[model samples]
Target chain A: MGLESIPVVTQSASDGLTGNAAAVLREIAARLESLAKEGQSGIIDLGAMPLSPADKAWLADKLGQGEVEINLELDGPSHVRETRYAGVWWLLHHNPQGAVTGEFIEITRIPELVLAHPADIISGSESLNFLIDDLC
Target chain B: MREQEGRLVASLAQQGISRRTFMKYCATLASMMALPPSAGIAMAEAMASSRRPSVIWLPFQECTGCTESITRSHSPTLEGLIFDAISLDYQETLMAAAGHQAEEALEKAIEDNKGKFVLIIDGSVATGLDGAYSCIAGRSNLELLKKVAPHAAAIVAMGSCAAYGGIPKANPNPTAAVSVSDIIKDKPIVNIPGCPPIPVVMTGVLAHFLTFGSLPELDKLGRPKAFYGETIHDRCYRRPFYDQGKFAKTFDDDGARNGWCLFELGCKGPITYNACATVKWNGGTSWPVESGHGCLGCSEPDFWDGGGFYKALSMPANPLKLAAGAAVAGAAAGVAISFANRAKKGAAKAAHETTTLADLEK
Candidate 1:
């Protein structure tokens, strides 16, 4: 049979309730609380976890969307979105081929990947000085 | 040792690969290897500063499918980048040098890196006919492996053939092929067993070695526990159907269309341990079971000799006759063995229940 003949079975979000999504939600909650209490940043590797598609949908629904949404174009496209809860962000990284390489949940003020590195800032400062020199 | 060149980070930067992209690649690898998120930064630092590890690939008695799997794995892939980062000193099929020049390159690589480079074996070592079944540059694979395996820091068996004597070592084997482990017992060996293993797995192992300065934690079968710990059945999408006792009897049945479990159709998912279920193939597109076929159990030992691919793993040859015989026997021994049989069956049932409950708890 052709690949197109294969039936696509999409499990409902409710199906996630019977799975490990509740436990994962509880873990996320605990991490979020820790982040608020001690300013501790944490990351949950969603790609490593055996999360079903339904579990992912349930998580997305529960987290809801926040104001901040970012798309990074580097080796590939990466999406960084804030969850409904402050200090909680969802991240998805894809390779240049457009296939997802990793997914994660970060409990922090801002995800680390979105921040500019100090080394880049130093290089930028050098370039700025060079531009001023050329102008003179 | 070869002169210490510029750091990997500087080299990648020269190639237009930024530090941010490198960090992202490290993070992806860290997640894939089930390492802590912070370990991604550590991996990035380690790989950036450290020199590229030398690798010497040795092909033996088999097809070059393993090489194809790694090289042609999704273009501009992180794994591809990781491979590019390595100093592959010698590879037979990929390298341009041939004849004595190729042999000289191999000798030079060994002499330079001796006891430091990673040795990757893709095919099985044929021991039959005084090791004449497979040879390169007038040297038997057996002699070559014996010579090279000693000086390498670690060896990676890259395919089922190199890991467990794959198809060549099947029943009535003519070549008397054997796995790398069977011959090289001293060196640390990691088996990435598959007809052709997933591309990322090879790179993941290499990344782990590069970052940690040692091999990743391996399962009893000498495979990395991160990828090979869970069986295909444990992580399969159709697992819920299997739990509900729904199964497809034939290729085109309604159950098959509904995506029921292929247990009756001889799916070896329950026995095979590999990352195909979750990590998937062809850029995470789909695996064998997802493509509407039973698992061939390529990762397991001696899978070729297990049985016919279409025959159920545990089904009796004649179900109706066996059931009828059991019924008749039960009736004849009703009085004599009933109490004893009930006791034994009750104990067995209790054990079964406990095991099932424990599995559900997990």
Candidate 2:
């Protein structure tokens, strides 16, 4: 008799993107690092490679790479006052199947901007750090 | 011809249950323990042959709701059945003896069982203020657990109260209660946790031990995975609604009335893992989610400490921001849809050209 291994749970579309989106994210990181070194006031758009063979092909055929980076003073959320945080790097990844499906963007890198709250100098600036914890 | 046969006959004579029903119950218990049918027969054989395994049920800083819940349990009269299931030699709460006599029974049980017999601890062991918040026989609950645990064959830390210190272990915990696993580090402690664990689950754990001469497999937190395998959400009837993005916006909303998803109404089923949705309570009648309220995740390690039930879990979103990612996905969908439309139109046009050429030839 033929045998079949029953899959336990069918992962949702959202989890599809979650699966190894990290590898694609690495390519975005490499590009971001090079652009940071330019040390010039100009938009460095990553319009070309989308961290995947499929995404890169799509990029190559249409809009090669992306628009240039723009530095502007924008309104912060209600919690934070007007504070300029530089290189708030955005990482975009392409997933063939996703909840939202396809390409998605996330703010990946950020330095600490101590919010001048009424309370004490909330010691270690850990809350503002963009890096995820070890549990990840 | 044998004394063993006579005793078996006597035990059987005392009960109305037949061997068949007994075997069936044993099998059900085995399945509940995540054991095969063979194990059920083994349990039946063990019950038939072996002498009753003595049990010492200890109560500590608790509301005794665990005991109350067990007593009220109806299914197979599990609490009633546990007598045949185990000796249940001494329980401070339910025993006939009281004051010095009760204390004597506990001491005698510990002495008689020695290195055998299991210990079933029902509540948290409070060490705070020299355990003055609660006391028995001029000694603390911690002292009693320490005294009893060393002699136990295995320890069943029953209820969230005994397993994870329950509500007493919540923030600013005044009593400084500790779980049975914390102090009884030498012996393996099987934690069957709930606000008050399901009665069948408690007996099932015992059944597995009696049948196999060992504890069933436990999770990282020393809970039996059979009953705690998947989240309540995974097994919840409302799970279908969650998949369809249907949620109860308010407590008395249409979705709530229809038994749709409780996610929006602070239901913790998605994060809480337990067999409640499947095994249910009161003889598989209904669980909390089925009745009305969202699951509070009473079986988990730190159900009390977890923030608001309505608060979305703070799990890392696959390193992709779901909201902004969704926006991009919307744009991509538009592009894809348009491309499909254009392709369809082009194909139709080509077909029309071929048809027109055929018509002209005719």
Proportion of native contacts kept per candidate: 0.44, 0.00
Q: Which CAPRI level is candidate 2?
A: incorrect
What is the C-alpha lDDT profile of model 1 across A22-136, one tens digit per residue? 7778989999899888988999888876677788998899999999999988688889999899988999999776879899999999888888766667767888999999999
Off by over 4 Å in 2: A1-136, B1-13, B76-78, B310-362
Error of 2 at B19 (Å): 1.2
TM-score for predicted model 1 compared with the true structure: 0.85
TM-score of each: 0.85, 0.61
Give one digit per residue, the lDDT tens place, for model 1 in B248-292.
998788888778888888898988999898878888777898878
| Candidate 1 Cα deviation (angstroms), residue B289 | 0.7
Best candidate, lDDT-wise? Answer: 1
Candidate lDDT values, in order:
0.82, 0.61
Which pairs of residues collide in model 2?
A43-A68, A43-A69, A44-A69, A45-A67, A45-A68, A46-A66, A47-A65, A47-A66, A48-A65
lDDT of each residue in B143-239, candidate 2, tens digit only? 8778888899999988998999998886557888888888889998889889988887787787677667888888888988878777889877678
